[model samples]
Target chain A: MNTTATLSRIFAGIQPELDQVDALFQERATSGLAILNSASMHALASPGKRLRTALTLLAGKLNHYDFGKLLQLSVAFEMVHLATLIHDDIIDEAATRRGNPTVNALWGDKIAILLGDYYLAKTSGLIAEIENPRIDHLFADTVATVCEGTIMEMMTSGRADLTVETYFEKIKNKTACLIAACSKGGAILSDATDEQVEFLHSYGLNLGIAFQIIDDILDYTEDQSTIGKPAGNDLRQGMVTLPLIFALQEASQNGHQQQVQALLNSDEHNEKDILEVVDWVTHGYGVDLSLQEAHNYANKAREALYHFPASSDRDVLDELIDFVISRRR
Target chain B: MNTTATLSRIFAGIQPELDQVDALFQERATSGLAILNSASMHALASPGKRLRTALTLLAGKLNHYDFGKLLQLSVAFEMVHLATLIHDDIIDEAATRRGNPTVNALWGDKIAILLGDYYLAKTSGLIAEIENPRIDHLFADTVATVCEGTIMEMMTSGRADLTVETYFEKIKNKTACLIAACSKGGAILSDATDEQVEFLHSYGLNLGIAFQIIDDILDYTEDQSTIGKPAGNDLRQGMVTLPLIFALQEASQNGHQQQVQALLNSDEHNEKDILEVVDWVTHGYGVDLSLQEAHNYANKAREALYHFPASSDRDVLDELIDFVISRRR
Candidate 1:
């Protein structure tokens, strides 16, 4: 399958931006660097797509805010995201992350928890050091929102009858809020107008949904080794994802409701049983519909970027729509 | 034995201040109140000397600054402290606190952790609302430091030879820093002069040290029924307190170091054996001397407040010095 050309283009464009972000993290993260080196290094060196940081950089550049601090803002958002994952692993009792022993698995829950707090506190301190109280306020509020979102997610876990609306609420808080904060924060740092910030926020919000949906999709389809996690980990944990949401509805009407429910409740499902469910969704038009929904979100994100003046940055952000919807890994 | 009349006066002074602090907690702790209410209420209802809040208010009033939002700070710090205890119970595998089932024992460690995070986030949000970024900065740093301190305490838990210097550093961060922050933050909020703020910080620091030493003393002298925790808990956990530090040094010089070390390292020590050591210390001159050292610290704490204007608030502050050291339950 052909990868999105825009992915490479955006990657090339943000190389300088990534270097600046690394430098800023190095400068501010000195006090506890030696202590936190293992956890922090593992978190930073993970080979994520860097979609969130790219959004911040592109959003800032689109608003004519070309500066070094955008990279810092990118790193700040990424660090916040990393901190959440560290805590999430503890909550999830996850053993392996990105193909390595989880922090809690290696260092125990206490250190993992403290390391997460350290990163969060360090992020706030770095923001405060920028001498911009506005940024500090927004960053603190965003982190608080992230915590609230996590609480909500925990509150909803193990509920089989959770609605799509509630799921939207969870994902909005869990993922979109920070993505929106990233774009909005970047725009604000660039002194973008309120309308521009709002637009970028909407863009990031929709993009985040698409990104998370793709993550859910990849859980079923990607190589577990490459993904650094087991396949169907969410379903094993009883997490209802987009495909399950759609398939359950379809199966209910098709007289396979009991079968689908049995599969969900059963821990003994063999590979063949799982493959049947995956095949049913992949061949029955649900996969196309789900991907199309992600594309629609990408389109909305592109529309949001139109509010800004046209620039190569804006064009790159527009291409992100295609990049997000089409990426295979 | 008659307790100090000065402590009774300080308790009376804190009654009104506590009402104010309780109201602030009630006003701001909107969400998770139902889940947290029992723990928070238990903490609120379970009586401590309320010395920290008294120090906060007294420091403000002594500097002739209005106690603007200082009550909120008081509630936040105390709640944060309580939250740590809840999580600490889980880490320590404790079942009871203040003669009641701990949050972890009652609701389980999972809930305890989330509830702890909830309160911590609430405290952060509350501190952010204090209209001064400097105080917020200090509050955030103090929380991180406290976590670091506890983590260090846990890391060095089983070691019998933990240094006096390291123990001082840990207690300073875990217990004293917050107390010092409360005093300094109150003074800062009240527009106290630099010298006055410094004086309050020193007072709080010295008081915190004395407070902790007294706590250590009570662990040996007080009964389990009165203390609401097992007597000699710290020693049972192999923690090196001031008395143990003193006894160990004395034992070392007397060539009985191995005996003391063997007692601490013993996998099996009945309550009788435990009390034998306790009785030896109490009947020995070492315990009295250690307590005398604690009293010395308390006197120095009162001395730190001596330079302030001699108002009733200052008198209440002086009374608090005796009350903290006098705690038996």
Candidate 2:
């Protein structure tokens, strides 16, 4: 099966919830102003795989989380995700996303930025409708953490001193925090015990870390057409991700440290040089080491499921851990 | 007393609460990233009159709202306001605010935009701490409305077809809604009856409407250096305000239709012609009519307090209405 079909298989149990989220997006991503309405509809027209929403739904399987409330959280989480992507496009100066022109590309940075703010406002408003204080605080704090993480990443870009700990911390804030919130939110909505809630949080945390590491790896391994961005785009933008971090450590003894350091120090890099760097990182034990890290986190994520009784939901969630590490893009 | 002293006097009863809000700002505007932390601190270093926070404090007097809770709401509201202003400075291409360089000026549009989002996330997180769903909903809904209003304003900016009604609607969404939320939030935090909450809403609504119109009027009547921007800057930015709307109609009736039309259609406008348009608008019943409108709303704001029993809070609130109309800045 193709990636989309395989992912759909993984999320099959939440198909109905996903459909409701689509309807919710159609109904809610609107404004009286023409420009805002158009910008929102355009952004909504194409979306990333609804993995975060599915996380919320899947986390609800055992607790029998109220479908309506879960759906609201799902939609809100997705919107916040989309808003961040839109903002990220501006920050990345990305020309496209998922093979479509980015909002920033189509509407310019100003409107793109405002529309992102609008979506965030809508997300917070949606979250406010949920009355549980824990869920309320979780999403809000997660939003703050996510922005802080991005800012921190921006601050750290181009620096040679990026530690493994700093990389993990940044990813946790930027990527893993929202995913963890999604999991915790589902449990908080249900009748789950505190222990159950903690399990899901840890599950999401590890899964998100693995997921981002894979994305970073894909920057080296995947083709530009498939990834919808230039290969090594992260490196070109002065971002040092997991794969590169590992490669740099290896390069210290492997005699490629000078090559990697040259790329990092200079503001220029040709496509050929980028490809060669990718080869050095990917072939010279970089991908293997990064994959090793990804699997470690993925394994830890699966281990969190040990808290719950065996069931089909657990089986698929367990399967999702592998799916995260294996996905190409 | 000067405007600042008079306003301080009006807020005298809530001085302690306001001081707590200041402390809260200092405590909360920090971030892990030095850039974000410094940016937030710089934005907070000079704040406009804390009128909205005072409204929250004043509204709480009747129900004896918890000081701690009110402080959270106050800080959140002020941050949201500051976030909007930061975003607005980018939109307006403003160089300075309150005689200090704007965040956009200091750090460029990208940082300013993200910092605005940062402040907003901070606001949402702060509000989430307040367990009252009504207050939560109020702030969230107000944020969306404020953004919508701004988009509407941007869309309507250069258009000659801007109606008085549209202007009212835009200002209500952009300005009045937040102010109303400030008032209603205070009441919500307190144990006020539904009727009292509604009155506070109305009071803020009218006061906010008057506040914006006076702001618009000041654009034309205030000195270029004293106002910290060029006189008639709003018209230059293609912003159609109350005074301009009145002036336009007067210009049309006085057979200056061609002159006004030329000004609207052509981007080129010498300072001489801009000053002349100001003369037509301000001298020909613009300021008077605008002031009249301001007083009308200010009076209605006072009328909302008719239901409240006489108290020191009520007295200060009544005086604040006058302050809205008569303040030079």
Candidate 3:
């Protein structure tokens, strides 16, 4: 969690600014509404790596971004992230996140849903403070796009005919669009040229796709502790991620698709078979293939930043391409 | 369902405009996201009487409201209503709303939550189009307030010592604030005087409180076919509404507190006793007393409209105060 070990060294200029963003994010998330304040306080206490917030800050460094508006928009982006995660836990019926009691675990799905909604409101409220109609519309539209992505994923869940293209579409909606919104928003607030904004948006989108690919890959490569939940829970929930999708494609090519199909069809009580699938995915070229895809997106993200003048901020943004792919969690 | 019997004659002026609002609401609810579109289209098909929408339209009649902005805001209000209902079904574990399949019932809680979130995004997106910062802030704050109210209600779900103050607070949040937002938004969009805006706000708040009180009353008094759920479902779900609160107070005074307490304490086996409590409440002036409180709120709501001169729109608005109190469902 000591991003200072990595990002701090590269972001010597905006480190203090990043810290202020963190402080304000923590403060703003604590609402005057008692339940939201307490629940969000609990959730924000075990914060994510703030990769999204840092993305906004780094993108802002591309031009003369208003610090205040940037901080507010950054908070808005993180709250959107929090709101989705809170709702996701309810859908996943997850009891914990990163070993901390999920909102649903602490308070039932009822409170969890409401608290998620509270975060949604806070997200809107923060964006409204910025009073930028274009940004507000972007955030709202991104929210719908995110929902669309997940709903499509659910619609295709447990199906035998999951396509590679459909999987990319799902991940783009579920993960990448919000990342693009964050960077695009930051760039919009900055005195950046249209080219710079377009570049950052593309950078964020590519990086987001790459980040989620690695995350899906980690579901099999990493242990429970490193990944924060049981390994292969996605498969357990009948969700097919990139690694599993790639692995299944390989299985079909090798004519072992029947075994993989049997594993997919079996609901539970197929621990030995589940392990077999995991082994096929890990020991085979599944991890390698997925990592290759991630590397490709990360390279594209790097290329998107090719036109930007080299600065400490742009340098750190470029380094995130590697950090996103290499990080354990 | 035939609003014609009541509002048609009075709303001849705004008939076409209201139709436009409905058409746009239907059009906007559908998304490129098929699941969201289908689910929302289904929910919108079984729409409530659009009491909240009517309130905005009727309030707009007070002055020269921007028909475009008012229509958009009204649709936004309704979407907010729809979103809350979608999530509330998850909380209530309700299979149907108004005798139609709830999103949760058809697609399970995960899809239901996601669809509800999509509606929320649509809500914010619609408001962002209006480009009014104060109105935007009001809607966002209203959402948080609504969540706070519902969370508090869930927190106090099954207590022997539920306070009337707390009960009012819950209804005000769960039901009233959005109504207030609708009317306030209407007034804001209109060329209404500031005093007129204040009056409409008060009218909305009081009317909303009355509307919910009657709704709770209907839960006990109406049959399953009428209310869309079983009679006394509120108490069955460990929820204490206005009628039950009054019934418990009466039982205490009449020395039948143990009977009421026993029924509340019992799980599901005491259907007979629950019926007995309902009988006692219904046959024993519970409905009368609850209606009396509703009448009080209705009178206050009417008082807010006293300053408005005679007009058909005002006439309809005045009649709604009584309609909310007198109507069965």
Using Cα atoms with residue i matched to residue i, what is each candidate's TM-score against the true structure?
A: 0.89, 0.96, 0.95
* Candidate 2 C-alpha lDDT tens digits along B1-329: 55667777778777877888998987887876889888988888774649988988888876666888888999999999998999889988888886899999998887887888888988988898888899888987898999898888887887765778999999999999999998889998998989999999999999999999999999998876667777888878888899878766765454565565567677777778888888778888878888889999998998997679998888888888888888877
Model 2, runs deviating above 4 Å? A253-269, B253-269
**Range of the 10 consecutive residues with the lowest summed lDDT in candidate 3 chain A:** A1-10
Per-candidate chain B TM: 0.90, 0.96, 0.94
Error of 1 at A196 (Å): 1.7
Top-TM-score structure, candidate number: 2
Tell me the tens digit of each residue's lDDT in model 1 across B166-270.
Answer: 777888877888888888888888888888888888888888888888888888888776776667788787766777667766664444445556767788877
lDDT (Cα, tens digit) per residue for candidate 3, span A1-104:
54336655655667788788779878877756677777877888664547788888778878896889999988889888999999988888888887789988
Order of the predicted models by DockQ, top scorer first: 3, 2, 1
| Docking quality (DockQ) for each candidate | 0.38, 0.70, 0.79
Which of the two candidates, 1 or 2, achieves a greater DockQ against the reference? 2
Candidate 1 C-alpha lDDT tens digits along A83-186: 78888888889998767788888888877777776666666555544555566667766766666667677766655555667777778778888988888888
TM-score of chain B of 2: 0.96
Ranking by TM-score: 2, 3, 1
